[model samples]
Target: MADRLVPSISLKDFENRKGEITKQLLDAAETAGFLTLVDHGITVDEIEKQFALSKAFFDLPAKVKSKTPHDTKSNNGWEYKAQLRPSTGTYDQKESLWLQRGSQWPSDEDVPHFKDTTTEFLDKCAKVSNQVLSCLAIALNLPDDHFRVANDPNKPDCLTQLRLIHYPASENAVGTWRAGSHTDIGILTLLFQREGEDGLEICPGRESHSSFAMGDVFTPLPAHTGPIVVNIGDMLMAWSDDRLKSNFHRVRAKDVGKSPSRYSIAYFNQGRRDFVLQGPLKKYPPVTVEEYFNQAVQRNFARQQAATA
Candidate 1:
């Protein structure tokens, strides 16, 4: 089989033909299960500024960074080592700050333009997410805004988690070790590469070796700087009756001297917790929120056990 590439859309073209663009997006999702977006309308300056702030935050002493610990409730604020473990059971060797779009949006009253800049970026991201959701609906042969009905505007808990992650370089790092191997538990994920270093890999599926077979393994397509890599997650896969795929991906530890640690900003487009996660449309049986939640818990537990053993 040939390597599959996702669709790429320029910013100007995306605005001009929203309908056609959405169609193309659906096509990519149905076929490749992922796509790289270009001209996403986010400016280079803004990207740089955000990265700089992330670097400054990470550079601070661990004690200072730990001031705002990760809270299970808001899921907003900072997290240190061991505070967050991957669903796969391994502890990610990085520290991160999670930001969300809500009443809890960080206050920048003292800092000049901080609030405005962050909010502007977030708003644009949300618009992009909306476009993506519309395309997902069309791909699933449902109404354009089918997913939106689940999100109640009055309750501001629709989580759009923006995670800024920084991994420190280690001298004895093994090249093939992983940050974690697991599928995301959301609708879609939008990731930005803040640094030039490459370690992220998307595994399409596991490959088996046979007597007549070569040692070929499924691997990730290398991503460029300007394009945003989009991948399907668990909720979307379930909703689509397995029409779309929830890809498994991981980050390998890089050589200490060969490359500096990696930095990335990932925006998770998630639905509100209160919303039931039934399969949309009449093609599949309906499932309740509680059922879905229990399944997720079990899946995580299994992954963790497998990882540890």
Candidate 2:
């Protein structure tokens, strides 16, 4: 099989040809499961600013960075390579700082404009995410704004996560990988990665098929700086009654010579924690978003308990 490119969707066309765009989006969701978003209200300069802020935050002294340790229950703040992969039995070789809207942050004593810039980008991203969700709802034959009620920006339980991740170069690059194969557990994910760093790979059409089956082709998703790579997550997959896919993906560790590191930001658009999520087809049992997230987080870090203990 040959490598493939994820389909592209124009946010600009969505309003004009909503029906057509919804059809295209549905087809892409069913087949490719991932798509590149263009003209999504965020500018290249704005993205660059966020990237610079992330670099500055990561560059802070470990002591200063550690001031905002991640709260396990709330899933906020910084976590340094703590995500353990169930498939590979090893932790990811990266550090991540998670943010929520209106959340507290370390004072700009270390990096100027870090808070303002991040908040701005996150808010813009949220607007873009809501547009995508509306398209998905239209594709699913629900009211155009059906999903919006569950992901409303003002609701306390409708929390979203903005994660800044840095994957440093490793000595044993061949033996160690950055992130092992796994599926995202949220409603949707919008990922912005630094240009020119190659490692992200996606196995399209894996969700509806058997997980253990061989011959699944893994395609390296384009890592260009311009477009945001958007993918369906488990929650949406379940809500669609296995219609939309949440494919398995991984990032291979870079060779010692390619680049010193790679940085990416992922904004996970989750549902209201208090809302009970159920598909229109009702193929699965209803589950509260909070329970689902808590379980997924626990499983991701389960094997690392002894080491930390």
Candidate 3:
């Protein structure tokens, strides 16, 4: 544990001098791919409400929860156990509900406006995301509104995935076990851990001259309340001219009896499909959406093979 350098920012600090703190955050992002945010302005009561609602949704009967089965192509809606990308050699052993911006809500007379609560949550998240994007622009030495153009309000194509994840307690779990060793594929990821059992490990890079035997160091990040964990994603890394790194992370199964089960909600903010994902500055060559998508698919497949082997 080389003094796991996770930057924790207070929301009050962000509100008082956003410009200064924004620069600091960007600097941290360039070095460490993750940061824990405090005083984020989102109330604890709100978090509790959302967590309760999520638990209720996931607690529904199998038939009800299965109504919206996981769609591989769309990558939207509920995903039952063993349906997601495998974590290491085993299944993720979690259930999740994926919600995208502007998606059609389920329509049943009794359950009318069933998605209202989720929609409200999305609105708040979007506000926070926009603020973060502004900070990112300033951090990259660009105008505050540079990335704002990427989001279209009227016909928005930005994909915002709200995933509710539940990782059960396991008796045979190893020390470093995880859902999988992977990296995110979007611009940025906003993670709200409603409850965590202390198995989330982030692998930091080793010294430049370190030997392969030394291995990349891994640091465990325990969950804290009222702080939203933000991680840089592949798209942002590419857009930043590789200045910011997208981190590699994994979630270990909780120890049986030692800790309670885990639950989290991750909101992935993605760029529009038509947005040409060229490097932010003029120094780097232009890259198209198609090219980026192809590379992501290739990388995902390679990882899958490696995991299986």
The TM-scores, one per candidate, come to 0.82, 0.90, 0.86
In candidate 3, residue 182 scores what lDDT?
63
For residues 1-309, could you state the per-residue lDDT of candidate 1 as single tens digits? Answer: 223555565545755677777777777666556777777777777777776677777777776666656776666777765533343355777778888765343334322455576667677677767777776787677887877655322247575577888877766666644466666777788887854667777655322100112122435555345567788777777777766767667777764444467888787777776666656544445655345545675666565667577
Off by over 4 Å in 1: 1-3, 83-89, 102-114, 149-155, 205-218, 221-223, 255-257, 281-285, 288-294
Q: lDDT tens digits, residues 1-309, model 3?
A: 423477876557566688777876787677777888776677778776677777777667877777766777667878766543434655666778886766544333324345776677777777777778888877888778766666533246665577878766555665535466666777778888754456677764522111111225667788755678888777777788777767777776654444456788888877666767666565456666446656776766665677678
lDDT per model vs. reference? 0.65, 0.79, 0.68
Which one wins by TM-score: 1 or 2?
Answer: 2
Q: After superposition, how far is residue 67 of candidate 2 from its true place, in Å?
A: 1.3
Highest TM-score scorer: 2
Alpha-carbon deviation at 82 in model 2, angstroms: 1.0
How well is each residue in 128-210 modelled by candidate 2, as lDDT tens digits?
88888898997877777777887776677787788999998666676356887788888889999878877888887665421
Which model scores highest in lDDT? Answer: 2
Q: How does residue 194 of candidate 2 score in lDDT?
A: 79
Model 2 local distance difference test score: 0.79
The TM-score measured for candidate 3 stands at: 0.86
